[model samples]
Target: MRLSDKVVIVTGAGSGMGRAIAELFAKEGAKVVASDISEERINEVSTSIKEAGGEALGILANVAKESDVQQLIDRTVQAYGTVDILVNNAGIMDNFIPVGEVTHEHWERVLGVNLNGPMYASRAVLKIMLEKGKGVIINNASVGGLFGARGGAAYVASKHALIGLTKNTAAVYGSKGIRTNAIAPGGVNTAISGTITAPNQLGMEAIGRAGSAPMGEAQEIAYAALFLASDESSFVNGVVLTADGGWTAH
Candidate 1:
């Protein structure tokens, strides 16, 4: 067990890659804190983990809200003593509309969740990690962060900003025993696509041309997270691990 006795917090653990990561971490002996906007979904993931003889705690939270994120950290500490890992995986997709077609509402919503959410969570967790003098943070970025046209203006902008955050966090805290990294996953089969509008469907289809690698499964990405969260990645920091199936190879 790579993460035996580690305390891990995985945001957006209600479904998709987040959920898979939570389950896998639990099996590897990490005490998992599964948080999501949906109470039912998070609870279900928590219940499954416990039933399988793993430790878990479910919390309902909107990562974009600082209050909710703070409370999440407080509760996790109260239950588990301290946080050892944080996976900022909770995120939303934009409608894939170009900047010219994007609305102010859409831009704010996407950035609030995709960018600000990670910042809020990282801020809350840093206090604990800093005091302990050791921790890990893994941000879920995307190929959209690496290039244009993979998603809408808002999504691309938000992800790119996230990569910046990851680097800054790593630089400022690496010597303090904290590590931060980002994962840029390409086309993983997940529920984020439901947010796509009809007009933007064409943009989604164009993803096929970017990579010959098959669309990734949630578990595939989860495995990547596992490595970053574990002791094996102790020497790795401030890096963006591209799990984009060769999308950027072009």
Candidate 2:
């Protein structure tokens, strides 16, 4: 149990990669706070963890809301007394609309959940982490963050900004005992794709290229996240670990 008794908060823990991360962490002896926007899903995940003899608390939260994010951290402290790991994994996908076709409303909404959500969560958690003089923040970025064409304008921009945030946080807090890193996942079999609208010409081309690459399992990403969250990655900071299956190699 590498995470033995560590307090971990995983956003979007209701399903997909987030669910995998939470379950794996609990199995590894972490007290996990499983958060998601869906009450039903969150409860299901928490119940499963408890049935498996693990400690877990499920909270319904819209990470894009600062107030909700604050309540999340406050509740975690109330239950666990401290925050050890924060996994900013809750995110949404935008229809693969090109920059020229992306609307302002869509852009704001996408950035709100994918970018501002993580920022809010990180800010709320950093206060407690800084006081403890040690903490780990693992953000779920995308290959779109590393390269264009993987996502629409808003999605790509948000992830790229997220990577910047990860690096900056690590640089500022590494000396203070906080480690921040990101995981850039390529194509994973997840529910996020269900939100995609019709693809544009550029998006279609990217999709074609993606079709040749192998899709990774949610557990594969959870495993990478687990390593980054555990003490095994104590010396690793400000890194964007690409969990994609050679999607970027081309």
Candidate 3:
């Protein structure tokens, strides 16, 4: 019951890390808002949580859209009265396309979901959180945010920017009772890899040079996120908690 009565919004909650985080939060007594672009997936997660005797609401949302983000927050407040935590977990991967060959469409799409989505959600939630004088924001960043060769150009750039945004938000709102942090996961077992249908040779070669690291489970990252969302991490803020099993150590 670490998060008893707390209202948490988790984006990309249909599957993988997001779904794990959403379910875990609910188990800890949080009223979870599971948001995703896919209605079917959202319903599945939400239903599972409810079946477990936890509170949950499934919201269909495409985080890339500003209007969607606004509506998400508005609906959460309407349902739960206020927001306590926001997890920006929705993201897409670039198909290992280096900058030289990356298309404008692909770049924009990746950045839109990975970066702009978090920005919009954070901006919208600040009003409620500021008034409450306490809030937590956790961004699901990646090792790509810390290193270059982990992903394609756009994906790397977006995650890097997300970490930056996390720090900046913490700095600006820390004293006002807001804690913002990020999780830089290495290789997690998620459907996001399915997006890489057409891999770029150079990009793949660059990653191959780094060698392979042990793949992590979605629940491991979810546990890390759970720590961030709970009071255990009250003193932590603006930190990029790397949960990659030391993949970047070497």
Candidate 4:
């Protein structure tokens, strides 16, 4: 067990990459906190982990909200003593709307969940992590953070900002035994596409120009995250681990 006796919090644990991370972390001997906005989905993931002889707790949390993020940390400490890892995995996709066509509502909603959520969660957990002088923070960023046409304006911007945040956190806290890093995953089969209700032709055309890459699985990313969250990555910090199967090699 790579994470034996560790306490981990994985937001958006209801499905896709988040669910995979929670389950895998549990199997690695961590007490998993599977958080999601949906109560039923979160409960299912938590129940699944326990049924597999792993320890897990399901908590409903909308990471976009500060109060919810605070409660999440408070509840985790109340249950598991302390948090050893925090996976900022909860995020949403924009509808491929470029800046020209993006409305304020769309921008705020995307930034709120994708950017503000991680910021809030990271801020709350830093206090706990700093006290212990040892902790890991993994941000599930996207290739959009690295390239321009991978997503809409808001989505790409939020992820780019997230990677920046990851580096800044790592630089400031690495000496304190805190490792903050990010994973930039390529296209993966996930429910996040459900958020793309309205696609913009210009944005779609821009993405088309970039060409397609092989799709990855949620578990594959979970493995990358596992490495980052474990002591094996002790010397790795403030880096963006790209798991895009050479999609951006060209």
Q: lDDT of all the models against the reference?
A: 0.91, 0.92, 0.96, 0.95
Which residue window of length 10 is worst by lDDT in model 1?
205-214
Q: 70, model 4: CA deviation in Å?
A: 0.4
- Tens digits of per-residue lDDT, candidate 1, 1-250, equal 9999999999999999999999999999999999999999998999999999999999999988889999999999999999999999999988777777789998999999999999999998999999999999999999889888678788999999999999999999999999999999998998776767564766555654555545889999999999999889889999999997776786
> Residue 162 in model 3: shift from native, Å?
0.3
Best by lDDT: 3
Query: 184, model 2: CA deviation in Å?
Result: 0.5
lDDT of 2 by residue, 1-250 (tens): 8999999999999999999999999999999999999999999999999999999999889988889999999999999999999999998888777788889999999898898999998898889998989999999999989987778889999999999999999999999999999999999998787777676787767767665656999999999999999888889999999988997887
TM-score, cand. 4 vs. native: 0.99
Clashing pairs in 3: none
Q: What is the lDDT of residue 169 in candidate 1?
A: 99
lDDT of 3 by residue, 59-106 (tens): 999999999999999999999999999999999999889999999999
* RMSD of every prediction: 1.6, 1.2, 0.6, 0.6
Off by over 4 Å in 4: none
Candidate 2 displacement at residue 224 in angstroms:
0.3
